[model samples]
Target: MRADRLMTIMILLQNRGKMTAKELAEELEVSDRTILRDMDALSTAGIPVVSDRGKDGGWRLVDNFRSQLSGLTMDDLKSLFLFPSGKVLEDLGLHSGALDTRQKLLAAIPGTFRGEAEAIWERIHIDSSTWRASKENLDALKTVQQAVWESKKLTILYEQADGEQNERVVEPLGLVAKGDTWYLVAIRDSEFRNYRVSRIHKAIVENETFIRPANFILAGYWEQSKEEFIQRLPAYDVQVEIHPSVMKRLYFTSKFVQVIKKESSSPDQWIEATLRFNAEQEAVEYIVGFANKMKIIAPKDLKSKVVSLANSVIDFYNEL
Candidate 1:
């Protein structure tokens, strides 16, 4: 806990500059004395962390002091790496070699997180298929990511979803993945765009340079295209309560529900709550089949729809 607290303090200072004992104590849930002691430890470790006492300031970093800027830390990699799932992907297809992903990532992580990172790498398995990238695409994703970091321009062979291909010079944004796909999020000719990494034939960094816009955030680009997914479900939110016994199995499964506002939860230690069916007729039919354990809830119209559908099914079967 102390080590974690110490790491927390460093990160806090790294993000917020500095803070008084009162602030750190309250935020970290430790006493003032403890905060002071932790500060002493940080200083002894030569963290360049500075503290000041004044009416105008609680604490602040030394002026113009800067730590080296790097890529993702051990924690960052761990979060991105995704466990158990990593183990699965090792067999599927994931690549990050000439991507120079490791060195850059190592540089980003703080010296403190190095150990935890090593342990995680040893324990976690990211199953990925052997990258089948033609030298061109393999080169393109690598170039695009590098250029984004270096602030440069890129000429890449990109194929759109409609099967169109062209060599376009674009400024890079970032990379994102969904299910088995990876995309290069970028700006081409002043327009924002996303290029699936698989379709890129080749990428070359042009000698030219480009200014990264002051107002750009990657998160804005990567959210799932909900409109595309919602088309698969019924008009309303379907509701189905699952039995508890199946909860653990469901929890262990990785669901890529492409588009669904379904849920599966342990209402107690014994019952699972699941909802999946947009149309009442469909939801009811699904709920009834699992009648021994599942229940339908909400949307009064759905109940009626389900009864009618069930009766119709019964009638059709009886006629047969």
Candidate 2:
């Protein structure tokens, strides 16, 4: 295990130059003393590990020193070939480049590791898109990506969820792909905002470039923003008794509904479950669809709405 940790330290220093002992310890999830000992071991092992003392000083490998990829273990080699979905690569226009990179890596690594890497590639695949054939309009994705890559400003015509269109100039920070959907994270009027790529009607990459914030990490920001968005959503809880047959279906429809908690089985074999929706209307719409398969246990208003909606549907059909 120490050998793996030592090799990881070397790789880290080789990739990201000048990491402080505290930083390295934090990254490797070890104590500072352990990192210092690892450094000593690397040095004694003929590794050119050096430490500088100053405000911005840290441990670094000597100039021109690079670790060999041949030192990677079988697991590491397998990890290198763990690619995302082909659709994701195509979205980023890296499908061909990804194929080329795989070939180059296979050619570059030692012959001993090549077979395992190639085998892993054939055995493993990832598809992050949903089952439904929903396509997003990404007409502005290329221009937005270009601005993000160039660290340039972007002027976009964005359509809001309410269908209101607005034009604004923003500092293109990064683009994030959540499943098949893409979002542009940018700074507009000194505030961080997320613009759905599908809603971006037009994008113009500005000639002027802006300095990227030193502390802005795209992944971290997106995660925090996602959490905040979920927290801000309106929660409407509904208690229901679902038939045995529809229990799995309730879990499957997770996008618009969340199963907050489940109670013990009812005497008649029905399942008591607590479900959450964004609004009362959403609960009414969903519960009404289940018809007799699901029955509302509490919240008299929701029961009334469902009955009223069901009768309305019945009456409308009867008229035909």
Best by lDDT: 2
Residues 2-75 of candidate 1: C-alpha lDDT, one tens digit per residue: 98787666556655666888988898888999988887887888766666667756655465334544665555
RMSD of 2: 14.2
**Model 1 error, position 59 (Å):** 39
User: Distance (Å) between predicted and true CA of 253, model 2?
Assistant: 4.3
RMSD of each: 15.7, 14.2
The regions of model 1 sitting more than 4 angstroms off are 1-139, 161-167, 175-183, 215-236, 257-320
lDDT tens readout by residue for model 2, 45-104: 999999999999999988736634757888788778887777778888875721245665
Q: State the displacement of the C-alpha of residue 74, model 1, in Å, after optimal TM-score superposition.
A: 15
